[model samples]
Target chain A: MNDRLTAAERVAIARHPQRPNISDYISALFTDFFEQRGDRLMGEDASILGGVALYHGRPVTVIGTRKGKDLEENIHCRFGMPNPEGYRKALRLMRQAEKFRRPVITFIDTGGAYPGLEAEERGQGEAIARNLMEMSRLTVPVIALITGEGNSGGALALAVADRVLMLENAVYAILSPEGFASILWKDAGRSSDACELMKLTAADLKALDVIDEIILEPGGGAHLARAITFRQVDEAISRHLAELSKGKQLGRYQKFRRIGTAVPKKEGQ
Target chain B: MNSIFAKRRARLLAMKSLREHYVPVGSAAVCPRCGKESGHPAVAQNLFVCPLCGYHFPVGAYYRLSITLDHGSFRELYPKLAPQDPLSFPGYRKKLEAAQRKTGLNEAAVSAVGTIDGRRCVVGVLDSRFFLGSMSSAVGEKLTLTIEYAWKNRLPLIVFSASGGARMQEGILSLMQMAKTSAALGRFDQRGLLYISVLTDPTTGGVTASFASLGDVILAEPGALIGFAGPRVIQQTIGETLPEGFQRAEFQMEHGFVDAVVPRNEMRDTLSQLLRLHEKGGPS
Candidate 1:
C-alpha cells in the first residue's frame, strides 16, 4: 500500500513487519552466538540483546536493540526501547568485551530509551550517562551501525564510536517528525513538512557528517531482500572492524574525549 | 420564531467565546495554593511563598539568580548567541521568537557567572515559562559553555533546572545537545570541580537524561516532578496506574536519584552549606 516512497516513506519500509532485526543480523553475521543477560543490579532487559559471538573466526562482542514482530514479544522488549537496566546490561557486556579485548559492534535500532517513571526512578539518566563514560574509557574498538530508527540519546548511548554506519533506509532523528510538528508548528498533521525539513535520512546524516557510512539496501527494501542486506552490512562491518583492530586509538579514552569538540560546519556554508 | 431563537443563541455563543478567550482577571495577591487573597507586599515579603499553605510559586530566572546568588554578583553570558533551526523545521523560529518575547529572555535557560555566598560559581537557571523550559540548541550550548566556563575558572557550578526537557523544534539537533552538554560535563568531571544540580518544579526528557541528572550533589525543590518520563507516558506504557506521588522529589530522594529535598526558603543557605562542604582541599 505504501508504494509512493521517499526518504520519509523509507522510514516505514525500514520498520516493515518482516524486516530482519538485530537477531536476524546476529544470526546472519556471526557464528557460535552466546546470549548474555542482566545488568547484575536489576533484572534483565530484553530490549537490549548482548552476547559474545565469532565474527570471521575471531571473537567479538555483538550488541543491539531488538523488537519483536508479535505483540507479546513487543511488550516484552518494550518495542526495543530500553530501560535503565538495558543500558546497564549493555555497559556490563561492553566491559566484558573490553576485558577480553574484543571489538564492539553495536547495532542501534530503537524509538528511544524507554521514558518510563520507573526507568528514571532506577536512574535511567545515570545509566545512559555511565555507558557513555565507560564506553569512552573502554580500551577497544567500537563500531556503531544504525540499522533502523536511531532516535536521540537512547540510540546515542550505544552509538559513540570510532565509526558510525547507517543503513540506506534507516532514519536517525532527534525526535519523530510528529513530535517535531506538534512542538514547532503546534500541529501534528504537519509531520510531512517536518520530515522534509528534519534531514534525518541516511544520506542527510552523511551530508551533515553525523554518519560515517551508509550501507545500501537491496531492491525494494531490506525486508524485501534480507539475505542481500545482511551480506552488505556484514561486509561493511568486517572492513571497519579490521581497520579499527589495527591497534589505533585503542584504549586511552581518546575517541569520546574529542566528541563534539568542534562546531559542526554549517551545511554548504 | 425558531429562526429568531437560533440567531439569539448564535449571538450569545459569540459573546461567550469572546469572554472565555480572556481569563477573568483575579485579585493580584491571590495565593495560587490556598486561594487566600492578600496584598502584593505580603507575598513579596514571604519570598513568593503562599503564606497560608507554604507553597512555593515557580520563579523566573532573575528571581532564581537573586535568591541563590549574592546580590549584584551576577554577570550574564551568551546573550548574543541565539538558537537557529538547524533542521529548519516549520515555524521553529516563530515559536522561539514568541517564547523569547513572552519570557523576556533569549532562550529557555540563562547561563551566567555569579558569587554564591562570596564563592565564585557558574550559575544557570532554566525558566519554565520559556517554551516550558525545553532545551533548544542555545540552551544546550549555553549550559555546556557554563560548565566549561566553570572548569576554566576553577569555580564551583550550581545549576537550577526547570525544564519539560529537550526542545523538539530543532529535531535531532536538539537531541545532540544532550550529548554535547554531557560530554562537556564529562570533561568537567575530570577537573574535580563541584557541580550541584538543583531541580525545580519539573525536569524531564533529554534534560534529565543528560547533565541535569549528572550532578555531584543532586538536589531538588520540595515536591518537584523530577524524572525522565512523564507520569502519563509511564502509565500508558506500563498499562498500570502509577503509585501516588510517583516522580516527585520525595520519591526520587527515597529512590537514591535525589540526594536531598530542600525547601525554597532554605535553598540559599543549604547551597552555601553544600559549597562550603566541598571547599578547596576540604574532606571528600
Candidate 2:
C-alpha cells in the first residue's frame, strides 16, 4: 500500500476487494461485537472506537482508532486524531472493562491527538496524561496491538497495556518519523532516515524493549491480505490472553505498578 | 629662498604641535575599584564579579549545568531533535538552520541524564544563543521526554531556562507545546518525582507561563529578567512608567515568583544542596 495516502485513501484501499480493513475481518471472526461511545462530558468523539465484544466466547473490550471509510466519515471521525472527549471515552471504557473483569484489548492507529484549538481549550493534554496514569493502575489485563501508525500521545493514551504487540510492518514512536524529520533536519524528505534512527518499526521497537511482541503480517502487509493478517493478530491476542489469564491475580498489580522504575543504584552496593 | 621654505615648514610643524597640546574631553576609562580597563575577564573572575566596576555578568546555562552535575558525568538526550519551520514562515527555516549550525546543537535546549554529586538526575540546559533560546516544538518535545524519562527511571529533573519565549515561526503549535510540556510535568509530579526549575537570564513569554514556573522549587539567577511580558509592553499598556527593576530577579523574589535569587558563583552549591535534600526523601 502507498504510505503517502491520507487516512481517506487508506480507508478506500481497505474497501477494495484486494484489501480489507483488519477491523472488518476481526468483526467477522469474533462471535459478538458491540460499540459504546461518549464520555458524557461534552459530546461523542468518533475518532476512538470502543466497546465490549466476545472473542471466541470470551468477553473482551475492543478499542481502537478508526479513520472512516469515506470523506464524510473521515470528517466525522476527524481522521482518527482524537480529542479530549475521545480520550475520556477510551478511559471510561477501560475503567468499565476493569470493573467487569474483562480483558482490555486496544488496536493502536493514529497520527496523534487532534491539535485543534478547541481540543486544547478542552484540556486534551490533561486527558492523555490522565489516561497514562490511570491505565498504569488498572486491575484487569490489558493488551495493545499497534496495527498501523502509532504516533505521539494519542497512541500512548490507549497503549499503556501489560503487553504491547505490533504488526511486522507497523510503526510506533513518540512521534511520527516525518514529524521527527521535519524537526530534526528542517526537511520532511529525511523521513526515511528518521524512521531508521527513531527505532519506530515493529522490529526496531521490539529490540528497544519498547514493544513486547511483533505479530507476523501476511506477505505484502495487512493491506494485501486482510483475512490472513486478522487471523495472525487474533492468534497472537489469544496466546497473550491465555498467558495473562494464568497470572490475572498473582502480583499482576505490582507488575504494572513497577513498569518504569529504574532509578540508578548508589555506588558500593 | 632656502630661509623662506624653512620658515613655512616650521610654521606648519608648530600648528600641528598646538593641536596635540589640547586635552580630549571624554569620560576617563578607569575602573572604580581597581583602576584598570573594563571588560577584562580576570577582573570579572576576581570578586565573583567584573574586573572594572565589579559588575557581574549573569551565568549562562552551560556553566550552570556543569557546576550542578558531577564532574565528567553528563549524557545528553535528544540531541538530534532540532527545530523546523512547520508553517513555512518566511526566513524562519533559515534562521533555525543557522542557529543549529552556529551552536552545533539540534535545538535551543540541551537535555541530558547525569549524576549530581553521585546521585542520578535528569538535567536540561537552555542556551540563550539560539534565537534567545526560544521554546519551539523540539525544545518542548525534549523537555516532555526528559520529564517522562525521569518519571520512568525515578530520577529528579533539573532544567535551566533562558528563553525569550515561544518560537513564533511555529505559530499556535508553539503555544500548544506549553500545555503538552506542562502535562508531561504533571505526570512526573503525580509519580512523586522532583522537578527543579532554574530560571536564568531573560526567562520570559510562554515558557514562563508553563513548565518553567511549574517546578517544585523555582530558582532564578541574580538580576535575571523573569516575566510573562516585556517591561516595555506592560509600561505601554498601562500608560505609565513602570517601577525601576520591575520583573527583575530581585523584584520577582519580592513578589514571591522566585524562591531565591542565588548569585552565579553560588548557584551550583545551592542546586546540589537542594538535590541532596530532595533525593533523601524522594519517591523510590
Candidate 3:
C-alpha cells in the first residue's frame, strides 16, 4: 500500500472495486510539473512541497506538505512539521505566483509547526501570523486543498485561501484531536471523542461553511488508487481556477477578501 | 551591704555589654535618644532596609541573580544589547537611561547561563525596577536569543518574569514581540526542551499572553499579579465586579493558570529541585 496516495486515489478506488495505483492516473491530470525548494533564509524544508506546474494548461503554484512513505523520510521531515523558515518559504512562493498573476494552490497536511526554542528565537509565530495577514491580501486567486490533517496555527498559516476545498476523509480544526483531548480531558486516549466534538471531518466543515467544497474520495480511502485521486484533485483545481480567473482583474481579487461571514445575531420580534 | 550592692551593679554592667555586642545591625544603626547615626550595617544580610528609618534601596540585577543561581556559577550573556528607543516615544529613552543608572543594569532583563543545583540552565530574570520591567525589543530579543542558546546547548531554560507587560513606547512593534517570543518558545517545545517560567510581582498583558504562560511548568511568586487583561478592564467588559484576589497569584493557581505558588525565600530551592527532577529524564 503506497502511503503517498492522494484524495484522488480514494475517489478512483470508490469508482472501481479493484483499485489502481495513484501515479498511473497523474499523467491524465497535470500538464507540466517542476519542483522548487529552499526557503532562501536557512535552507529548504522538504515537508512543504511547492512548484510551478500547469493544471489543465494554466500555470499555477502548487504547494503542499508531504508525509513520507517510510519512517526515515518522515523522521527527516520531522513528520511534516514545518519550521518558521518553511512558512516563509511558502509565502515567498505565494508572492511569486501572485506576481505572475498565477493562481495559488496549497495542500495542507501537517500536525503543526515545529515548536523548538531555536524556532522561537527565529520568530516562528510571527512568521506564521505574517503569512496569514499577507495571504489574506494577496492580489491573486488562492485555493487550498486540505488533503489530510489540518492542525492548528501551522495549517491556518497556509490554509488561508480564496476557496478552501477538503477531501471527504480529511480533517480541519484549530488543534489536533489529541491536543484538544490533552487540554480538555487530560487524556490523549479520548482523541476519538474529541474529534467528534471538534467537528473536524470534511463533511462537518462543509456543513459549517468552513470549507467551500468537499472532494469525494474513493471507498476505503485514497491509498488504494493514487492515479484516480490525482485526477479528481486536478479536475477540482481546474474548475475552481477557471471560475476564479474569469472577470478577475486587479480589483476582482477583493471578492475573495470576505468569503466567510460570521453568523449574525437575530433581534427580538 | 555597700560592697554587695557594688558587686550586683558590676554584674548588671557586664550583662549590658554582652547585649550591646550581639545587637542586630538594624537595631544598632539608629540612636534611640537623638535619632543620630549608630554604627551598624544600613542594609541587612537579606537586603532588608534599615530598621530605624525604614528606607529601601534598589537591589541590582546581579545581587538578585546571585541569590537565585548556584553560588559562583552564573555567567551573564548579551549584556551589551540594551534598549534603544526606536519610536522616540516622549521621555521613554530618558526613562530607560534613568532605570539603567538606578538599577546599574543595561536593560530590564539579565540573561545568564548558570547552574541551579548542578543542573545547567539558562535564566532570564526581569527586574521590575527597570522601566517596570517592560518588555521592549531588546528584552524580547535577549529572551529569544537566550532560549535559542539554551536549545542549541540542550540546557533547561528558566525565566523569572516580573514585568508591567509590553513597552507601550514601542507601540505595535512592542506588541509584535509577544508573537515573536511566543514563537521562540514554541520552537523550544519542538526540541523537547524544558522551559520553566517563574512569574514574580506583576506579569500582565502581552507578556502574560505570550511565553510567560507557555512554560511546561509555570510557577509564580507569592502575591504576584498574573493575568492577560487587568481586572478593571475585565470587570468593565463583563459589567460586574471581580471576586477578591482576582488576577493574583493565588487566584490564578486556583484557576489552574499557575502550577504552584512559591515564596520568594524558597524560590531557589524549588527551582533547583524542579531542574533536578526534570534532568533525571522524565517523559518530555
What DockQ does each listed candidate score? 0.28, 0.03, 0.02
In candidate 3, what are the lDDT values of residues A88-142, reduced to their tens digit? 8898999999889888888887766665533443555446655655676677888
Query: For this target, which candidate reaches the highest TM-score against the unseen true structure?
Result: 1
User: What CAPRI-style quality would you assign to candidate 1?
Assistant: acceptable
**Candidate 1's error at B80, in angstroms?**
1.7
lDDT of each: 0.78, 0.67, 0.65
**Per-residue lDDT of candidate 1, residues A1-269 (tens digit):** 22346766877776787878899999899999999999999899999999999999999998999989889999899999999999999999999998999999999989888877668789887787666656655668889999988877899889877788999888898766776677667787887777778888888887766677999988678888788898899999989888887865433234333333343323210
Candidate order, DockQ descending? 1, 2, 3
- In model 2, state the lDDT of residue A143: 87
Give the per-residue lDDT digits (tens) of candidate 1, residues B77-125: 6656567776666677898898777666777777777677787788888
Clashing pairs in 1: A174-B172
Off by over 4 Å in 3: A1-28, A248-269, B1-284
Highest lDDT, which number?
1
After TM-score superposition, the amount by which residue B191's alpha carbon in candidate 2 deviates from its true location, in angstroms, is 8.8
What are the per-residue Cα lDDT tens digits for candidate 2 across B126-238? Answer: 87877788877777767777777888889989888888876655533454455556657756888887888888878876677567777788888767787755565446445
